[model samples]
Structures are given as C-alpha cells and as structure tokens.
Target chain A: METEKGKTFRYLREKREVSQDAKDRLREFNRAKKEILGALKEKDMTVNELGKKLDRPGHEIMFYLMTLVKYGSVEAGDIDDMDEYFSYKLKK
Target chain B: MSDEIRAASYDALVIGGGIAGGEAALDLANNGYKVLLVEKDLSIGGKMILLSKVFPTLDCAACITTPKVSEISRHPGITVFTGAEVTSIEKKGEREFETAVTKRPRYVVEEDCTACQLCEEVCPVVVHDEYQYRLVGRKAAFIPFSIASPRVAAIDIENCTLCGACEKACPPKCIDFTQETEKYIIKTGTVIVATGFKLFDPLKIPRYGYGVYKNVLTSMEMERQLAPTRPFNTILRPGDGKMPDRIAYVLCTGSRDDTIGNPVCSQICCMYSLKQAQLLMGALPMADVTIYYINIRSFGKGFEEFYEQAKGMGISFVKGKVGKITETETGNLILRYEDINENRVMEEEHDMVVLAVGVLPNTDPLSFFRNGELKADQFSFVDQAEVLSSPARTSVKGVFVAGTASGPMDIPDSILSAGAASSEAISYLKQ
Candidate 1:
C-alpha cells in the first residue's frame, strides 16, 4: 500500500537538494574566469572597469578576481582609489 | 575497517566527538578505562575547531582543540568511529548496556585513502559546501576540512553521477562504488550524551533579510573572516567586496524570541559577538563597528572585562532590538530598531550587518533513546537532575550528559561539565 506521504529523505534529496541554480552559477563562474583572464592578459584594469567591460556587477567580478589573487594567478597592484581599492593585473 | 557486526564491549561509550565528548573519552581513557568514541560527522573536532579564536582570552581556538583531537586519536584506550550513529541502547545488566550503532559508508577507505585532495580536484561535480556555511564550493568526493581527523573523503551518494572520474584518478584506488551500511553491537557500562548544538538559521526571520540580502551575514560567517585560514584576502563586504567601513551586529537574532519558538537566551552569542568586535578593531583599524542588543550578557568570568575593552575601543553598544532590515539600492543595510535608552525609534544604515545567531539542541535523528528516554525540558536540552551537584546525571541510570547536549554553555563550562560527567560515569562503573 502507498504511504500517506512520500519518503521525506528521498523526496528532499531528489527535489529540494538538487538545484539547477548552483550548476548554472558554476558554469557562469567558469565563463567569467576565462573572460577575466583573457581581458587581464590584454591589459590591467580596475574592478569597476572590469565589471563595466564584462557588463556585470563590480562585486561579482571582484569575487572571481579575489580567488585568482589568492592563487597568485592575479595580483592586486597599487591602490588606485580613495577607499584603498586596487587595480588588478594578471601575474606575468 | 572491518564491517563485521561483532558484539564488542567497553567500559564507557561517549556518544559524540565534539569538545565535551572528546574530553569525556580522554578522561575515561586516562583513568584506565576502555572507551569508544563515536561521531556522526565525517570528522570529530566539532564546531569549536571551525571557529577562529576563543572569547575573553583571544587565544587561537585551533591551538587549543588541535592538540586535544590529536591526543584523543593517538590514545591507546580510545577506539574512534566516524560516520556512525547510535540506533538503540538498552540496559541489559547492572550498570551494563547494549548499544546498536550503524556506520555509514564513507566510500573512501580510511586506512588506504590519503588526504591528498587529488580526487577532490578531479571530481567534476561541484556543490555548495555546508562546512563553509555554503559560501564556497566542494566536490562530490571531499573531506570536511583540511585538519579533519581520519582526514578521509566521503562521497555524496545523493549527488554522485557514478562517472568513475574519481575512481580512475585515485593513486591508491580507495574509492569504492559498492559499499554497504555497517552496524555493530556495542556493550558498555556507561554512556555520555555530548551531541552539540546547531546554529539557528536566520532565514526564519524574513524581516532580518539574511538570505535575501547578500550584505547581511551571520556571526558564524564573520568568524570565518577573522580565522587564520580566512575565507578571503581580508574582511570585505560580501555584496561588492569593497571594504566596509561601517558595520553593525544584530544581537540575539533567534534567541529570546517567542516568535521563533526559542525563548531561552543562547549563552555564547553575547561574548562571541564581543570577541568578533574586538578582533575587527585589530583586523580593520579604521572600520566603525556597532552592536545592537536587547541587553549585554557578561555572565562568565572575565567576560565583563572583555565587553569593557571593546566599549573602550569605541565599539558602539546600542541597547535596542532590531525590528527590520531593508537593503538599500547600493547594497547597504538599514537597521530599523527601537533604542531603549533614548526611548525612540531609530534607523541606522551600514555597509554590512551581522546577525548574532542563537543555538538549539541538536540531538541526531531528533530522538536517540526509545524505552527509557532521557527527560528533556521544553527547550529539548536534556534535563539535569541538579545544576549544582548532579549536573551530569540524567533520569536514566548509567546515562549522563555533557556540553551543549544538556544546555547552552561556553567552552570552559562545557569542559567542566564533561569532567563532571566523567566522574559520574566512573562512580557508576565502580558501583
């Protein structure tokens, strides 16, 4: 006989736990990483300029840039703003 | 590593692997009693190891917990089990009990698997990591963290695509596609409940804008920032990563609120928020930090001094309860609160806001005991016989409680409570 409700554990795992949003965002992150690396290889740019170039939020672009910076693939150069925000460049 | 369901016996069985459980196990082991330490999580250091530093003293938290974890693991008398849960426990004889425990498969063999993280690197599937509060990504095949005891990776079977990518990439070939859940019958003289607390999810209060606004963070999230192995380069606003000069902390987010059904005061939030505020003074000197609270609780020793120190450092303390948080167009947060001292409603805008989250008892599977269930109060914290003398004794004989398993407590209190539990268990065994 069928139960009153579907098994919660299985239901949550199949429906609630699986999110298409995460997979989409991960894909977008990969694309952004490639674009950021390509753009920086051409010329150094501030976070705002890169955001404008990519047509994305400055904050979103900075998140990707920070990961690269941590891995030594990207470097935050001299402070270029009153807020101590820096221009970033691909490490040569 | 053998999964044979053999009936084993021990002098003591510690039900958790957190600070309290670890302490109990070590105490019993040091006292010449064979002990079995079980943890439901992939690793056993518990929530304390995830934190940046301790309160009042500002000592590195990892420095204190790491040595204890390492010692517990190396102790000859303690048998450690991760990815395990106690299913049923029954009293068989005088001061002797039989416990049925089930061990979930980690997919990676602990004996053969090295913590190389190579399989993690190769695994194609990426998901939100809960250990990092879902702020980062983890592969399907992964360990809890770098310093995890046993340091073995587990497969998220729910998400595993069975692509065989991780299997092929393994140097030692520890990944097993076909693994079954293993159960064991453990007989022990005494049992200690030390399962810890879980943080209150702030999303419950939609007005606070935790999940809705990227700028709003939980105190646990902020702790990751102050940690030695920080989540980012420095403490920056999550919304735009522009260093936030103005930050506000909303104290008692989930506690003392009948609306959330948790009316008890979470004892640790007040001191931890103060600790973070002091840390921010050193981490970001120019930043202005303010804490909004219903009341400041400095009940523990030296806690009052710590609060005074933060106030002296010019960290603003407003005795107010925040009613709502609305995100500005520029990703800032405006906290609407009632300032009790001024006797007026006030609104303050800041670059970022942190919610001082509360804690709730987290008994795994909600309930563990069946026939002789230990009595718990309205808050789900195991009811203590007496707070002064019999702090560890439960209604069930040969069963004791420690750490947040019994109630909300600080680290020192948890350790003291663990000692009480160990002593009680020792006395029970002697009888």
Candidate 2:
C-alpha cells in the first residue's frame, strides 16, 4: 500500500518515456542478472567457472558478480586454490 | 536542509565544499558572521574525502574530514546547500552581491530519508560508482559513500530507469520523483572561491596504455583500492583478479609535460606516490615496489625524511622518464625508460602500473561573476594579485580565493591557504 504522500508525489511526477534501445538494454541486463543468480544458486563458483558455465567472457561475468555483490544478492568468498580468482556464492 | 536559507541574506557565501571551503565557512561562522556554503555535489566533503591517507603524516583522510563535515553541518551560523550550483553573480553594491543558485533534485526528500539503504538495495540499475573511482558498481539510488555528510541517498537520475522499485522498498516512503530543480536568490556581503582541482586524465597519453590496458590505473584508482571502504577484499589487479607481485608507479604522467598543455608542476605528486609506495609495501610484504621519476621533489616538512624512510624499507626509486609501456600476452607490463644515472635505455617488467597523474586548475570562477569577471592567471587558476602580502586576495575587492583554487598545493598548505582566505574575508566584512 502506498502512503498518501508517496501516491501524490508519484501523481505529480512527469511520466518517463523510455526509449526502445534503453528498454532493450535493460532487458538484456536483467536476463544476464537472472542467469548469474540461477547459476550461483547451485554451488559456489569462481568467475572463470561461471563464465564457462554461461558461455560469457570472464570480465562480463565479473561485472555482474561484483554488481550482485554490492547489492547484497551475492557474496564473495576466499581466493580459489589456484590463488587467481575469488569465488562467488548466492547470499541466502 | 537549511530551508530558512531560501530567501536569506548572508555575510559570506563560500563556494565549494572541500576541506578549504569547509574551513573558510567555519572560520567566518565562528567570527559571528552568517554564511551560506554551496556544494555542487550530492554531498559536501570534496576530493579530500575520496583520499586514503595524507603524505608524511599517514593520517586517515576520513579522520580529518568527517569531523569537519559534521561541524559544518551543526554550526548555527552556517547554512549548507548540497547538490546546488550558483547560476550567476551580479554585484549590486560595494560589498553586496546578488547570486542566483539552482538546487538539483536528489529525487528523495532529505528530511524524510533515514539512510537505511533499503531503497538502494532494491534499485535495479547499476552504474559506475564515482566515489569508488569507477572500480566497482553502485546502484542508481545510492548514498555517495559510507561517511558521506548528511548520509542521505541520492538518485543518479542519468542512470535511473525510473523503475519505482526504490519507492516500493523505501520504509519511510521518501522517494519522490516529482522533485524538480529549485532556484533561490542569495545576497551575500563577501564571496570565497575554494573549488579544488580535477585530476589529469591518463587516457591523453596514448603511450601509457591507460584505458587500453586492463592492469594500468591512475593514482586515484589505486587510492580507492587502498581505502577502508575498498571494493575488493584485498588490493588485486583488475585484469584477472590476480595478486600483483611487482607494481610500478610512473610519476608526472600529465604534469611537467609540454605536450599535455599543462607545463606546471602539480607540487604534490612526488610525495603522494612515495606515500602510496610505502602503503603498498605495508599491505604486500613480498611485493616489490618501484617508482620511476624525472626528479624527486621532497622539499616539504618531513617530506625528505618520508622519502628516506620509504627507501629504507627497500622501495626502489629509479631516476628515469618512462617513455612507453607495452603489455605482454600474460598481462605483465614492460616499461621502457631512459635511466638517467646509468646513461642507458632500460626495460623492466611489472604486473601492475599506476600513473601518478597531475592536477589542472578549475576555471569555474570565471563564469560565477556577471558584472565584472573574476580574473584567472596564465595557467587559469584564480589570480592571486597580492600573493606576497595576502595569498588569498583576488583581483576582485570582496572576492577571495582559497586552497588549490589559486594553484597546486598539498593538504596542509591548502588548510593554511583557507585560514588566510578566511582572515582576509573577515577583514573585508569589517570594512
């Protein structure tokens, strides 16, 4: 339920007109975010492992992982046995 | 939110919200003068708050900044306006100036916000966090930093999708998309310009491979990594998240170079790079740290001693100019330099490279005045015509300049400069 103040504020806001390109980009980002979360739910994995699983580049996977980490949807664990990558796990 | 300041006349208006401006405002307010402080950013603590530690002292930058930020906020004589810009200044009388200021909307009411971060947590958009030097991502609805004064959340309207998730998640329902830019007229007796500098972009030097190389970073980006609120658990190269065993610092990246159109010394790069080297040695005991410089300027209080201390800790200082940096296949960087003492071209390999970029003079003061323009020196900083007698006196009679607004200086010097500016402004008001 929206508070009266919030409802009035929303009514006063100018309707945002999002472009088709921006919508498409948001959809793509949402898709990637969902895929990353689903994959991380199974088990903890390094960025390399997640990239391999998703068939994405390591840097792209790293970006989403870090974003998720910041938002508290994901957590980063200790460095892997190879001492190269930090493992990511979904925060329950 | 300083609501009473809307139609107010003040004794002083201090532009910029960095350490210098904070000090100036505090000084004027303590002297029984009403003040209005304007900061263009969402929060007031400027570049000083973004730093990790100061050179020679190694004091936590936040330790010095947070207290001042709070003091400025609590002072009854000073009213602060964050996320606000002065549009124009017209001189009406000898000491009175009519200034028009525009306050940008944060999209969240400051009084209603609890800073609980629930809105930030629910925000879907992720953008480069400017506070973290873009090394990590921050939500579109975010608090600027952990220790940000006012501790309020602001919406990055540029990146915000207007998804309304934050509105739904907010407990106090503080999210307000209806807020628009508000304008106010302020009449002040005197003005102090303390707007600080912007760092040089390393991308200008193509040979350095700053943007093209994954492991190469600017001094500020490295500073963010060393900060307590750092993105990563440890200081690791961004390329592959690998620990860099060997790190190199290239001094005078954009300053002291004729090609970059900035031919003045930045005045603090040498000591700051030395400070970072010492910090890196403490953080990574096994790592080998090296600094390449054309000349080492350690001519400040305890600065030469700090340099000697860094050297005593086994940090290598190479007297050379790094000509170019080439990246290898495995992500190691090769530095090509002319070793001055050895009289030969030399090459070295390191896992990471940090470019100690310079600072440029901000030319914002020129546009602040509409009647008679505030003048700038040849290098474009606020002109100090009476630097010998009064370093803070500008070309304008009632307008003064503080801190790096005039030229390049270290933190201690900036504080001293602010004190001088405050004293001059007080005298001008008394007249």
Candidate 3:
C-alpha cells in the first residue's frame, strides 16, 4: 500500500502538470551530456582529464558523466576501471 | 578643579543601530524615556542600508532607513554611539542593568572627516569591503559606503600596512592611528537586544557549489552586485564576467532543512527571491528567471500580490526541492530536483544560480548573559515563552529581544517586533 505522505509527492507532479516542461528541460540537459561525452571520446580522455581540460568542478563533471551513463552515451562498466583522476572516456 | 567626569543614565539601552534598534530607540524616546543607541559600525545604518531595495514594496531600502538614522542621531532624548560595542552587561538592581561598552577608534575625527574620500584616493593599500559583501574593494582608509549615515572615513588598521599615505593626504589632518579604544559604563532600566541575524554561509552546502563556482552567489552577495554603484553595475558571472541569459534561485538553502537543523521556514526567502527575480527582469527584461521552492509562504500584506506579480512577469516557479546544484560544461548551473507535481526527477540548466540562504541569530548576545537569561529555540530566536505574550521577551525581567534576533522576520515584522519590544520594556518598567 502506498504511504499517505509518499502519495503527495506522486500526486504533486500530476497536479502541477510538470511533464511537458520537465521532459523538454531534461532532454536538453541530456543532449548536452551526450555531446560532452562525445567530445571526451574524440579526445581519448577520461572524466578526470576532461574535468582538468574543461576546468569544471570535479563533482559537477562527475555528475555530468553520470548523466551520460543514464542516457546510454557512456557504458556503466567503464566507470569502474576509469581512474578517479583520469576517468572521462566511455567504453563500448 | 573638578577632575570627575559626569556620567549619564538612560531608561533604555538599545544594542545595534539597524531598523529594529532605530525603531526601538525612537519608540522608547517618544514615550518620554531617554534611550542610548549603540552601533558597532562607524555609522548608525546597519545591514538595512546595504540593501539595494526591500521586498514587497520594492522601496529603496537606503531611503527608508536613512531618515530613521538621521532622526535617531538628532533626537535629544535618543543618543547614538556609533563605532561602539557592548563589552558586558551586569544587573545593577531589580530591573536595572549596567552595560559596559567599548568604542573603537575611528582614526579620523567624526566631525572633521568630511567624507571627502580624499584619504581613500591617496591610500596605497586596497582591501575587500565587508559592507559590500566583499564583492568590491575599498581603500585602507575609507567611508563604509556612499550612504553611510554621519558619513565618516575609518582606517582599517588590520590592512593599513602602516603606509602613511592616508595620513599625509588628509585635508582635515584628522587621521590619528594612535587613538586608543575607549570604554564607557552606562546604567539603564531596560535593555533591548536587536543584534540581527547573519546570513548562512552557502559554502557549507557543497552540492550547490557556491565557492567552487564563481557564478553561484548567496542572496546578500546578489544584493551588492545589483546595487547601482556596484563595481560592475551588472549581473555578470564572476568567473567570466558574462551577463547570464538565464538565472536560477534555490530557495530555503539553509532553512526548512531538518538535516541542517534549521527547519522553520525562513519567512522572508520567498518574498525576497521574488524581489530579486523582479529586479533581474527589470535589468535584463529578456533573461529567464526560475525559483525552486517547496512552498511559497506569502503570508504578509502585499506579499501574495508581489508573488503574483513575479508570475505575471514570466518568472517561473518550480514546486520542488533542489536535490543538487552542479555546474555544466558551459559554466551554467545544472539543478537536479524532483518535481513533486510530475512524479519524476528533473534537472535544468541556467547560466547563474543564487541560493536564498536563511538567517540565524547573532551568537554574540549569549556571551553577555551569565544565567542564560536569554534563550533561543532550535532556530536560534529569543521569542516569547508563551503564545499570548509578544514574541520579544527574554527570561530576564527587563531585557527583551526584537527583529531577527527573535526569528526570521521580514522588514515589517521586524518593525512590529521592535514596537512590541518597546511596549514590553515600558510595561516591565511599570511593574
């Protein structure tokens, strides 16, 4: 059974009609993530290398990389072997 | 020859010279009681003067506060001591307090300083201005700001570097580096603690990436940047100095968060965020502004109207809790939040982000009361012990607290609390 408080979060989205805007904004965000991942592949660089090259905050860069994984632009398995400092490239 | 320096006494001592203190002092003095108003800064106008504009009405904050500052300074019954701090407070008798205050040396005589700013031009050392939220620089010897009441220049001995340029350039020849700090003991029947709250440091929330990302700024920092005389006079990214096409404001950054231990709604964040959005729209007109908030509490008069006006101005309000804020590849902000209405997780990108950080009580007052006569709830406010009474009383008999010292109140609520505190003090005196 759905909990009483948990239902509010579920109903809130439906009532607010955030589907259209959320879908569009998320799509745009994901597109940028894929492009960044593609650029990393072209440069043969890891996430850490891209972070240093782009001068982006590490957590932010990592979050972007995670977005790539969510969008299937970067393989999840590759994230394991990628060095924390030099992990940017996605493996097929 | 009489060697004794005569001492003066007052009915009430008001600490801080901000809106609440000014109002309290005025209210007490108008009631025919002598009031001593002490301010730690060189001028009587407190943080209220630093604001570009106030919320709801969007009135010029300086214009509203400067008049009160002038009135407090000129009132015969109200004596203002700028550049002073309460060193200690002791109970002299039943319902009486003796407060020891220390006055810092201004280096330049107040009457002769003239605010010519000539000393600033010749001063060699430049230091970050604390009054401008450190977004701008000031000379080693300088007036705090353009509208600083009783305009006078002060020397920053810490950053002076002892370069004698200000001393040599002083047309009034008022620079005195060796001016000793003076102490005074004053007795009063009542004390009103109006030391206002401080903005929460956004650095604590690493996910927002405040310090790490130059484009992200706290609400107060945004105010300084929006000021007409601000260094840039434009809302540009600190990292690259580019005007952002889109901006996002994360509401309740520190407040309404059980994890941060500040669960109460900050009371003013919603309205102030709306004000900031309106200001941004006026500046750029085409720039996109979005506010992420869990709930918009427009409980005050004209507050709901202001919120509706922000909506009419095309400012978007997303009912969500921003889970994390990260910077994108293009130096834009990536805000991840769960859309409660959509039943899905979503993220948006914007060029700059502002965190509407909440306020916390000034911790300095606790040092003065030994018996814990003053107490703050979990939210760090000294409100009344019961619901029936005014929310300005302390455990101590004749001492009271007002403004944000009581809780996160807006300008109107702060004024009301100041008036309430004055009445409470008057009643205490009667008893």
Output the number of the TM-score-best candidate.
Answer: 2
Best by lDDT: 2
The alpha-carbon lDDT assigned to residue A10 of candidate 2 equals 50
- For residue B356, model 1's alpha carbon misses the true position, in angstroms, by 0.4
Task: Return the interface RMSD of the candidates, in order shown, one decimal each.
Answer: 8.9, 3.0, 25.2
Q: In model 1, how large is the Cα lDDT of residue B266?
A: 95
TM-score to true structure, per model: 0.89, 0.94, 0.80
* lDDT score of residue B171 within candidate 1: 81
B282-329, model 1: which lDDT tens digit per residue?
Answer: 988999999999889999899999999999999999999999999888
The deviation in Å at residue B130 for candidate 1 is 1.8
List the lowest-lDDT window of 10 residues for candidate 2 chain B: B1-10
The candidates' DockQ values read: 0.14, 0.39, 0.01
- Model 3 interface Cα RMSD in Å: 25.2
Per-residue lDDT for B90-160 in model 2, tens only?
Answer: 88888898888989988888988999999888777776688887777788889999999879999887777
True contacts kept of each: 0.11, 0.22, 0.00
lDDT of candidate 3 over B251-314, digit per residue (tens): 9999888887777788888888899899999987779999999999999898889989999999
